[model samples]
Target: MSLQIYDTKIGKKIPFTPLRDNHVRIYACGITAYDFCHLGHARSALVFDMIVSYLRHSGYKVTFVRNFTDIDDKIINRAQKQNTTCAELSQRFIDEFYIDMKALKITPPDYEPRATEHIPEIIDIIEKLMTKGIAYQADGDVYFEVEKFPQYGSLSGRNLDDLKAGARISINKIKKNPMDFALWKASKPGEPKWDSPWGEGRPGWHIECSAMSRKYLGDSFDIHGGGEDLVFPHHENELAQSEGASGKPFANHWIHHAFVTIRDEKMSKSLHNFLTIREVLKRHQPEALRMMVFATHYRHPLDFSESGLRDAQTSVNRLYNCMAACAALTDGTESSKAVATRAEIDKLRSLPDRFQEAMDNDFNTAQGLGCLFDAVKSINRISQALPAPPAQADINLLRRGGADVTKLAQIMGLLSQEPQAYLAGYQEKHLTAVGMDKAELNKLLEERIAARQNKEWGRADEIRDLLLAKNIELKDSQDGTAWYVAGDRGQ
Candidate 1:
């Protein structure tokens, strides 16, 4: 089957053909790194991550480059508050970002170039724009000449004349047109500055991405993605800057993920309604978070709520149990379930094909996941038969089906963790947060251990019930006993 994706540029779904044979180059706008990442950031990353994953699964060699805007105004402002250099503050968040990404199971991009590390590349692009008369300098600042780029509003489908009338203009003396955006801003006192032909100033927010993307992915790339909020000024300006400088199309496909809202309102720090990734992960399993993202299409708004997460958690738990049950059913048991027959296994093998069909239709993750849930439901029923220790063929069917879910989940950077480990961490974090004394809990657990060792199942069950009353959970794996407290709390 041929791969197809919805191209925002064409406003339609089309067969996906790589610029090069069996190769794909994708550029996703990364975080500014001024503070902790939020759910919105996670969504954008995961959305493109899925694109990259599916492309690879379809046999394309993908070069994924996600840049870091480490030299933005926000980083400088944050540095001032911390009484540190912008480089120091940006690096701190960059380091923290990877930690959160790991916890969320989001894969790192193939290339993560930082803006500060690529000043020369940014300056070269700006110089090219200047020589081309697409950009001009004024009072040590350089701004893109919107008039030179006649197609400036085409990507966004907005008329500049209308935008100028309705939009509030910035009070910058250097701007020749109300719509012309800055390519570079002159340095301020005590702020980070880089030497450029134009003057000692840093790259503007949008230019860094254009320069970095071009520097890594070349003049034109397969796909460019970011939050839908960036579709207007940010990505629109990027198209102008990169294409204007290179005289080539910026990206063949433009992908944008919709905003993550809280109670129908946008999640923003200014609005005081955003939940940091660290805070949210502190409460829920990362896979559950990823599932929440997968529940909605990339182009649709997702509203965050406790009930939604609860539903996601329940769904994840059920999936985990199904996978576990499949793992447990060994070769031919006394109670061989009819659902694990040769005919049934063959039916299960067709799931990946169905999953690919859903993904081929514009990366429809919701539909793809529905296929996954259907497979998981079927497997749960089959595993009950406990077929004489399931044969390699049977296990292979389960593995293939489970791997499909795992692969899709990973593409979205969700549910890629060992199910037991995630459950353990989820329980431990919640228990520890609820003001439980570990030493006291351990003493009670030790008593239960002695009873279980003496084959006193009743006493062990009784002791376990007492801990359950305190909202503590115990899981008995082959290794030993582990306990955790439970609650919906934030870090």
Candidate 2:
């Protein structure tokens, strides 16, 4: 099926046709850099990341731009609270954002512009708006004239009257209309400021995205994405400012990921329920969090909970175990069984098409992941049916299956680790959680191996029971007995 994306402006899924053939230009509104990223930020980042990945995988030359709001009221306030300058505070959090995105395996955008760095572009847009009579200066402050733009609320579907009634307008009493938003804010004492036609001031929040996106992705781009919360005021204002200034559509497609919630409550710092990406990574494997995010449709709200994360961890464990089993069957030796398993391997080749079909439908990662799990199940079943030390043909089949699974998972930024390494790391994490010392566990394992070698079955059984009591179980393979946390053998 052809790619279809849900455009928030039109409120329906439409075919994704790029303005330029064979190329897709996308701009996603990035973080404010005032604090560490949270689950909500992860969802938006991963959603757009997956979208860009799929677009490129489908043979489109995608230039993705995501901007940082490094100079904002929040950053200023946070800087003061932390006893630092705005630039210093914003830089620290921007660094932290990169770390979080790296941990999540999110692909970096082609252009990551910072609002502070695009001051010239911002000033240029503001100047254009002033010349076009779409913006006016009020006591050194510049405000977008909402009434001047006939379609100001078309993207958000809110008329000017309704917006004026609902908007929390600035109490400065300088704007001509209640709904007029600031394009440039006159600098206050002790605040970061830049020289502009409207005097020394900084660009407003909405204006920053418009200026940065235009600078990198052009005045009109293919897709503009962010969280659903940005649909109004943020994105809506962006449309007015950009279109009002350039007299062209700001973006052809509008995509927004739903919020990440905790127990039905929005996860926010104000709510005291915000879980930073770093904290979540420390508690669970990063892949597990990625899995949890992809489990739900991108446009749907995701409920964050410890149980959900644990379930996702279990799912990732299963995939890795399947990979490990497939790896074990593919030792370099040749066997006759390879020919017999060829059909199963051939079946695995069709997975990419299935995965793509799910992703093409508005970047439905949940369905795409479903396809991945289905392949995992097929590989596991094939492994069980294959004989130990099977024909070279069977080994090839298992190898093919493993390679195909890894390739598909990599597109979603999962299964990047070696199967053995992932399994071992997961085992170690569980061991630590259960307070099992690795050194002590290793000593017991060695003693048990010696007992089994000497035919002291009772003593070996005793050691097994002792380890099991601590939630560690021993799996005996041809090489040796390996210990893992009990109840987590990827069963």
Candidate 3:
């Protein structure tokens, strides 16, 4: 099936056809780079990352561009508070952003342009707007005249009258209309400054995206995306500036992911409820958080909570466990009866299509993950039923199924770690949570293995029961005895 994405501008799902055949250009608004990234940032990054991954997986040559607003008011304010330059502060946070993104296993964009690096491009766009009479300079500040652009609110679905009624423009007496947004702001004594036709000032938030996106993705791109919070004045004003200056549509598809909320309220610094990616990763595996993000539809609101994360962790652990079991069964000898039927092999091969189907329907990651979980269940079932010296054909089937599961999981950025490594990490986390010393538990397990080797069955059973009393369950396999927290069969 062809891809169909939900277009925020049209308020409906539309078939995704790139301007050029077999190639897609995407521009997603990146962070302001004033502080550490929060869960909201992580969601936005992962949503686009999945989109790009699926696009490439579907055979499209995708050029993804995500820009950073490194010279914003927030950066300046933060720099002042931290006793540093805006450049230094933004660079620090940008470095931290990369670290967090790497920890979450997010792929880097093809081009990560910084707003401060494109000063000339920003000035050029503002100059074009000025020449077209869509922008005016008042006391060294350049503002896009919202009344001049007929389609000013088209992208946001707000008419001029409605926008004016609810406008929250700065109280600068120099503006013509209350809704006129700044394309360039006059620099103060200590703020970042650039030489522009309008004067020494930096580009506004909206203009930076317009200028940078156009510079990389051209006058029009396949998709332009950001959070739902940007739908209002930010994107609305960006559309006005870019289209009004170029006399063309800015982007074919406008994709906006819904917000990440906490306790039914939007997660924000002002609410004092924002959770940073670093802090969350400190407590849970990065893939667990990614699972939590993907478990919901991209356009739906995701309420961040501890319970949600635990559930996601459990789900991820199940997939890893299934993978591990399949790996174990792959070593068994094959028998003719163990050779999967043609129909069975076909069904296993069709798993990728099922996963693609879910993803194609507007990047429905939740449904895609459901398909993956189904595969996990099937693989686990097959592994559990394997004979004691499994047939070579059945071993091949199990190996193929494991490979298929890993490949499909990669498309969604899950199950990247080695199965044994992931399981060991899960066990470690469980031990830490239960206040059990991992070294002590391992020493006891060693003692039990020694006792069993010496034919001391009673002593080995006593050691097992002692561990069981502490909520630990031990499973003995051909390799060795493994222990995990009780009731966590997935681990």
TM-score versus the correct structure, for each prediction: 0.86, 0.93, 0.93
List, residue by residue over 61-168, the lDDT tens digit for candidate 1: 999999888988788888999999998899999999999888876777899999989999989999999999999998988999999999988777888888988878
| Ranking of predictions according to lDDT | 3, 2, 1
How far does residue 374 in candidate 3 sit from its true spot (Å)?
A: 1.1
Computed on alpha carbons, the lDDT of every model, listed in order, comes to: 0.81, 0.87, 0.87
Candidate 3 local lDDT, 24-55, one digit each (tens): 99999999999999999999999899899989
Task: Give the winner by lDDT: 1 or 3.
Answer: 3
Ranking, TM-score, top scorer first: 2, 3, 1
Clashes of 3: 6
For candidate 2, write residues 300-322 as lDDT tens digits. Answer: 98999888888998888888988
Weakest lDDT window of 10 consecutive positions for candidate 1: 330-339
TM-score, candidate 2, is: 0.93
Clashing pairs in 2: 334-392, 335-391, 335-392, 336-391, 337-391, 337-394, 338-393, 338-394
Error of 1 at 111 (Å): 1.3
Per-candidate RMSD vs. true structure?
4.2, 2.7, 2.7
